[model samples]
Target: MRDPLTVSGPEGPSFWAEHAWLGTHVEPGVVLDTGADGRITAVRTGVAAPPPGAVPLRGLTVPGLANAHSHAFHRALRGTVQTGAGTFWTWREVMYRVAARLTPDTYHALARAAYAEMALAGITAVGEFHYLHHGPDGTPYADPNAMGEALIEAARDAGIRITLLDTVYLHGGLTADGHQPLEGPQIRFGDGSADAWYERWTRLRERADGDRVTVGAAVHSVRAFAERDGYAAFAERTDGVPVHVHLSEQPAENEACLAVHGVTPAALLDRHGFWKPTTTAVHATHLTDDDIRILGASGAGVCMCPTTERDLADGIGPAAALQRAGSPLSLGSDSHAVIDLLEEARAMELDERLRTRTRGHWTAAALLRAASEDGHTALGRPGAGSLEPGAPADFTTVALDTVRTAGPVPGLAAEAVVFAATAADVRDVVVCGRTVVGGGVHRTVPDPAGELARAIAAVTT
Candidate 1:
């Protein structure tokens, strides 16, 4: 591969070559030559230069990574949740307290900072499982979708693509036989019923073909919507759109689901036809063999929030076995426990090692696929996860010479990316040919860190 020049014209093959040893990943045999639209227009192995008049971009490239699951506002709880006697349940209590407090303005401010952090961490897109709907009184806003719009604009301000998984969270539990009722902040997240919420969900704004956002759906959980048709009804209205759910993150959730529905959360969700290519199950920490099989056969993907799971003592999902079982894997920083894709990917395997006491299970190649390709699938944008031609030019370039990836060739970049690197190692981030993270900073917004602090202050104090 020769050094390529930068393109200035309206059109030309945007030539980018990998002089570093490449990480043969995802479709290991496939190659790509991408246009400005981020679609690969050509395919072949071996490095090829642009056909003249093309602009060259320097740095090692991988497909842009997708954060398949995120609760952007929760990024604020990173340090706040680790206090005394903390567990997922206690964390949930604090989360409700915060949720009970956010105004649409506060959400936009905090979420803008959160999405900016995601972009800086090499996340090209995020599936924001937004459930902080309505106001403190639980009444519909004058605009109905005002809160949703704030989040969308925040993503735009951050310059990262988003699949807003506008969540429908009805009920406090599976039923009176299940958990409790609307307590603290949980009231703000609920919308009455599956059909009523679906009507409001359809009222969401959508992005254009070249737009950087898509409106998706999420059931707070099977525990939140135990009725058989809860998710199915929502999916029907979505018409094959991406749907996400929080499945069995804790044993208590699994126990409750079984006690009420006589089935695992996964089985209950499957019986209703809510598991599919367009579906994403967040956490999915506690699953039965039957649960695993159902997720695999449905062609659904599990988003492993390794850092958050570890932080909250949430059990690990069967990431490797699930993939082998035919379900794809993806990564997320749910709760922003760490908010680093590299750490998220590495923890996927480390947790497996802890469980099976095994040496090797998930490889760099597979984790990259999950972080990039599988994540894009759940984001309602295909091919945005890789660097192949005609694929979305979404990618993040790390400092090869940095301590995180020291002594690494481009081939090992993927491995180094998984095990050692941090968001700090990412030197440049490209999303749809627009630079989001450059020189260790976000271009569109000044003082992102400060903005985040201010936003959090506004919400907390």
Candidate 2:
């Protein structure tokens, strides 16, 4: 008799994992059946060997990691800025220099390479926090949304899903004096006003392919979005879509928001009707008690980019407090400081340890959920990041035989994978039922490092 867990599909191959994380825990003898449409038709556990034609996955398979927040072009700055001692302000100067050099063609090359690197790290989907638009002189491209289209194409080329976060960057900077006009490199990032941003966003949305791409919106930050009128209208029009914003990543932003608006950035967003269930507040580092309450009460999620936060000297966010306050947690590799979600998952616990001098604030399962399920949810792919029937056939395998993951018992595999494993330990990656990476090598994009180097050089040189 056919197995009860088996179901009909488009005749795609099945996957049998030595161990697969079924949301809460790791289970051995797990088999995942994929249909022609790249969705899981059934999942069965405790199967002894690869069922008939099932491909064998010999590792701890988990849902494909979702990078919920990313600045794709920032990958060019990875090793270049580490030598200097600088604040986030100083780093922005360097980042702006790189941003100034990108055309749509160059941005596509860089993003494609960066997304390919992410695939190698087991990332099946990315939330690209894209803001660099127009030309170096602030003029719109011939197509207006050329830069955004490049990003969507980049993801398709990399064989991953993407939420093209079309960001609105209006003002140059905010101060007690009020909103400043766009200057120098800042000009390219602006769409003149929120209305213009929405106009372009609407066109981009209409053009976007819905199968593997999502059209989302973002408020660059309190500093960049000083005018409320445009974004308020934008908020109403963006129902049922994912919206992200930079909130209090640095104290300067909070101080500016308070000086001009007389409220925290979170409160300002809340006032503008930007805080909703589909919205996510990225960074959210220097939030107040009220900010925490606002985010949690609104059912909005928070994405923590631990490595980027540490690299930028941004203080640790109130992660556990936010989670306890009813906000779901998610993870991101923002800035690509490191592409590994495992490191991001563990750093949340470790950073909290440093701040409170306490241990075990989060369980391994919770961290995994944040990295996988919640991250996908934040990127507008609801019901993704799982191995259940009807979920996307997206998952990765981490070898238990690795030096770092050598000693955990079967039940404790999730903990070992989270705390001890790195991106280097990923053995296989399947996205939409397609094997993108196997034996730790990307199947399509050969020489990812070389591609990244060439792409970065095209922009930087």
Best by lDDT: 2
Q: Report how far off residue 236 is in candidate 1 (Å).
A: 2.2
Tell me each candidate's TM-score: 0.90, 0.97
Per-residue lDDT over 216-255 for candidate 1, one digit per residue giving the tens place of the 0 to 100 score? 8888887777564455666677656788889889898888
Model 1 alpha-carbon miss at residue 18, Å? 5.2
| Model 1's TM-score against the true structure | 0.90
Question: Among all windows of ten consecutive residues in candidate 2, which has the lowest summed lDDT?
Answer: 1-10
Alpha-carbon deviation at 233 in model 1, angstroms: 2.3
Q: Candidate 2, residues 377-432: lDDT per residue as tens digits?
A: 99998999888999999999999998999988988999999999999999988888
TM for candidate 2 is: 0.97
Whole-model lDDT, model 1:
0.75
| Candidate 2: segments with Cα more than 4 A from true spot | 1-9
